[model samples]
Target chain A: MVKRGAASCLLALALPAGAAEFNAALMVAPEVDTPNTASPYYVGPPLVPDRASRQDLELRLREGGFNVQETLRWQTIRDRTPEQHGIANQFYYDGELGDGLGWTAGKKLMSWGVGFGFKPLDVVQRENRRLVNRPALVGAPVLAVERFTADEAWTVAWTHPGRGEGSDDFRDASLALRWYRLSAGGDDLHAVARLSHRRGLEAGVGATRVIGEEWSIYGAALYERRTRRLMNMLVGNGGTLAAADPMSEQVGGGGTKAVAGAQWTGASGWSTLAEAWYDADAYSRAQWQRLDALTASQHALAGIAPAAAIAGNVAWSSQAYLTPNLLRENLLLRLGYDDRDGFRPYAELLATPRDGGRVWTIGAAFEGNRQRLALGLRQAGGADGSAYARAPIRRAAWAEWRLALF
Target chain B: MSRRLAALALAVALPASAAENVAALLKQADAFRLPAESVRVETQVELYKNGALDKERLYTVYVKPGRRSLVLMKSPSEIGQKVLMLADQFWLLMPESQRPLRITASQKLLGEASTGDIASMTWSEDYDGVVEDEVDCPVPPPNLPEATAPPKPRRCLHLDLAQARSGVTYARIELYLEKSIKLPIKADLYVGSGKRAKEAWYVPKPIEGQQRIMAMLLLDDIQPNRRTVVHYRSIVPKAAPDEFFNPAALVRNSLSGW
Candidate 1:
């Protein structure tokens, strides 16, 4: 039914009598990995297996005062069971409503905040953890209205039936508003407020300024109230399932997240970015030590049948509670060189300062007239009780080929 | 003295006085480089490294002197990128970004060419010129299809230009202007330490419905074997809407393929 709906929307966009354009691409990627432990936790087969392929199609149309855009993707993974999925990535219609007002409605990807890697105000979409090099966010259905002048803009949006993990039903939707300003010295300032039926109120502020010819700095901070709190699940005496004990619960206490970053670009096409992220709700150093000890005990009990269930529960709890930048303090660094013609090489490092754990990714891409080829390698390193010590895959290598079609 | 001899000497002195004023020569050259009113043009640039094609890009530009100018990238990797210049300020917009980013004019755009080099052409407004010399120079012929003869040496005015603005990329430049048309023929750019950084050649091309003018520019790096050629394909004289220069329009017309 979802596929049929997407097809209908595509047809509707195509039927308009106006100038339309279409673009498409096909990509095939293959990878190999080495697990950190012999018995690794599996999450229903990896989304990207040893080999995977994807096809994407995009269409755009402009008629009168309205603009329409649509993108569709089909992906398949070559695993033991072979999995496939089709997605309507983005479809939106934007038009002016007179009186300096404009509106957009449909499914679309929206991004907020000023951080390069970690965004505190980007609440609509869940971050893709597997691929840290590129952002892969799912679009949500929304209606947005905006008004603009020379130096200021005001926007209000309503999102219904959010598609990601923590979203609830259509009845429990979200509303957001933002005010953006550009100062005389070319500085940007933004203030945003949001209300979710299930999650209470949230507010955020972001700013960006250019320090000199080669440097730019940006930061963002967000506070949320009445949010869901993640906790460790407790097992019963006989290893029986306890319905009363849940992994997460709603709490009245509020939490805050902040991120700051800077970027520098040189005259020779070399650029670097550095960012630091902080999560107030993250586990402290002592709490993380306690969790690590509990995990060790659970691993030792995996042999006993009755205790095996409880061990699985423990593993699930650890996965649920561990979030990106969960070590309270984290840093990200990215370095890249682009000749702008075809060749580009980049490297990224994500480090947990408190636990001394880090993940490094390095890649290079060469682009031709109609094709692109890329090769990448990723490695994770940490101490015994560090954040990445229990990572499923310690090292991995991958290659991808993409061909453009019009 | 004879009356005829005195008149002849006066005529010679009049021409010499006109050539001595380098400021007038610069003002004339600037008039030939920029259009009097707003104009839109399509441009293609090719960069060569070691005599081999290294990169190429296409752009659609709208220019209104003393007001604002907008350049929209149309080809290669960054398809929907744009650059807006308003007086001393510059902003950049990427396809996926929501706000325009502030940028510096000295940033490199391609081989040997800075963003300011491609965006602004009225050199007279940014530099103060001093008369250096007047000598015979070998000038390339106008960029017309029928011209095939090798360039013969002609009398040209040589002038030294000092930057008048703080954020300009080059501190000093030596320029050569053709005596007949008062058009720039060649230039040598100098950096902070007074070292020659690059050389530029202005080639004249005939506009379809306008006066003959130099419409193509070539910049060559002094150290590396690199060169960039910019060709003004077409120019249409018309004023663009005010919104076209607004940064907010970058997001509102994100899908318009501007």
Candidate 2:
């Protein structure tokens, strides 16, 4: 059924009239994973996989105002069954409702903010920017009306309509409004607001200003009525182990997210970026310490309780590793160079200052006329007993080869 | 005594008259590149390394009266990319993220920084200078591609120009124009450090019974082996809507057929 539906969509995309563009890509990505054993949360053969690889074929077609993007993915993991699925990344139609007014319907990517590593004003699409082997973005279902002038634009969208809330914030039904204006001095100013039952009301403002010939700076801040995060119910209750997972999503009071960054690019092809951001949804230093103590107590019950139960509890506690940021405050620095021959290389370091946790990544990509190759490697480290230091995955490396078939 | 009196009169009025002449000359020269007040230019760029074809790209450029330009990348690899230029300010929007990013001045360098630089260039608005001398037009070096070179030799006016505004791509330009028609012939581009960066040649062809710049050849002085040939496939006098140039509108997939 998946293959049939995808093929039908591809045919539908090609049948459009008036200057249609059809492009297809064939890509193969193989990844190697190195799990850390010294950490208390490592799960070896049964639950967690040792390695994984994916092969993908993506098609994108655009005609007049209609656009469709669909990808077919097949994956293999060590000691696990192969998985296959079809993903519709973006499918939307944009048309003019009247003079200077526009309307867009269907699923589309609507990302807004002013940060590199983190974006505070992305109320409709809370994208995690640092994911390894980032997949194509799956747009939110929205019906948006927008208007633009020479220097100003405003958009009001009903996102995920009729679907109240799902697993995360991206699937929540909400009304989002974004107002953007280009200041007289060339500064970009933006204001965004989102209203939803899951999180009540959220609002933010952002600005980007270019300095001299080689520098640019930007900052943004968002206020939320509620922030939701998973917490261990028995962290301070002094429980050795539990028969079931104790982690559950809990809603907290109002919180704030902010990011500030500056970048400089030189004529010599070298560029540097320095950015820092605070995420109110992530765990704090004190909260990590308490979780660590709970995990230690669980390990002490290895002989008293069933080993499987103890292992499961520890794995449940490892959920902390899944958050976008390990701690609230993060600082990121990146240095990159474009050789001007379609090759670009960069090195980046992301550090959580409060807990001294760090992540180091290096990557390079070369793009030819119709082919692209990318390779990257990342490692986690920091002060002993820090959240990143005790993470399950210690290092990862991957490579991708993509060819455009038109 | 009459000749001496004429020379004295010339010396007293030269400064103000020269400024006006330079402005007029620049406007005349600009008409060759931009044939209309608002135009849509279909351009193709060919990159050559050591006289061998290395890569090719296609761009659709929309230019307006107020130094505003929007470039759409048409190559397969860069299908959804766009660059918006509003005078000294520039923004680049990549297809993957669909977010507009403010770009620094250095990132506006033609060919290397962004294609929008070369796609939209007008000297009358960005530079002010004085005509220095009249001399024979320089011939295109044999290494340049043929269709883009001037066909015959003629007297030329040598102009020395300095940047009149900040955030411009080049700080200085030594321009040479055909003395008779004031048509631009060659330009020596310079960087902020007084280093000659690239040499550019303008190629004019008859379009609609009038001579217009149909092609451009850019020879890199810094990288001796690199050369870029730009061909304007079509230039139509059509003005896009003002709202399309807004930076925030870059993400909308609605610019097609505009």
Per DockQ, the best of the predicted structures is 2
Query: For residues B1-258, could you state the per-residue lDDT of candidate 2 as single tens digits?
Result: 564355345534555433247778999999999988898999888878899988788898999988888999887777788988888899889877888888887776623424744555679888987676667898898867544345566888778888898877789899998887888899999998889988889888999899999888888888878888888899898888999999989988766786
RMSD of 1: 6.3
User: Which residue pairs overlap in candidate 1's backbone?
Assistant: none
lDDT of 1 by residue, A1-406 (tens): 3575477456745664546533445556666666556323332234214445544444444343444444455555565544443455555776777645678787655555567677777665434333633422445678898887656777788876453324342234688787777788877787777788665788999888876556778888989885454655442233333334445543547888788998887656688989998876566666566555555565556666456465455456556434655567889999988764567899998888888878898999897655778889998876666756656557778777766553
**What digit string (tens of lDDT, one per residue) describes model 2 on residues A1-406?**
4775486466656575457887778888888878888888886755667678888888888888888878888988888899888887788899998767999998888989789999999888888898888877888989999999999999999999899876778998999999999999889999999999878999999999999888999999999999988999888676768778899898999999999999988877789999999999999999999998888888888788888888899889888888888889999999998877778899999998888888999999988777889999999989898888988889999888888776
* TM agreement with the true structure for every prediction: 0.81, 0.94
Docking class of 1: incorrect
Any runs in candidate 2 off by more than 4 Å, and if so which?
Answer: A1-8, B1-20, B110-113, B147-152
Lowest-scoring 10 consecutive residues by lDDT in candidate 2 chain B? Answer: B11-20
**Maximum-lDDT candidate:** 2
Give the per-residue lDDT of model 1 (tens digit) for B127-183. Answer: 875656566754543542222323566667777788886556677888887777776
**Model 2 vs. true fold: TM:** 0.94
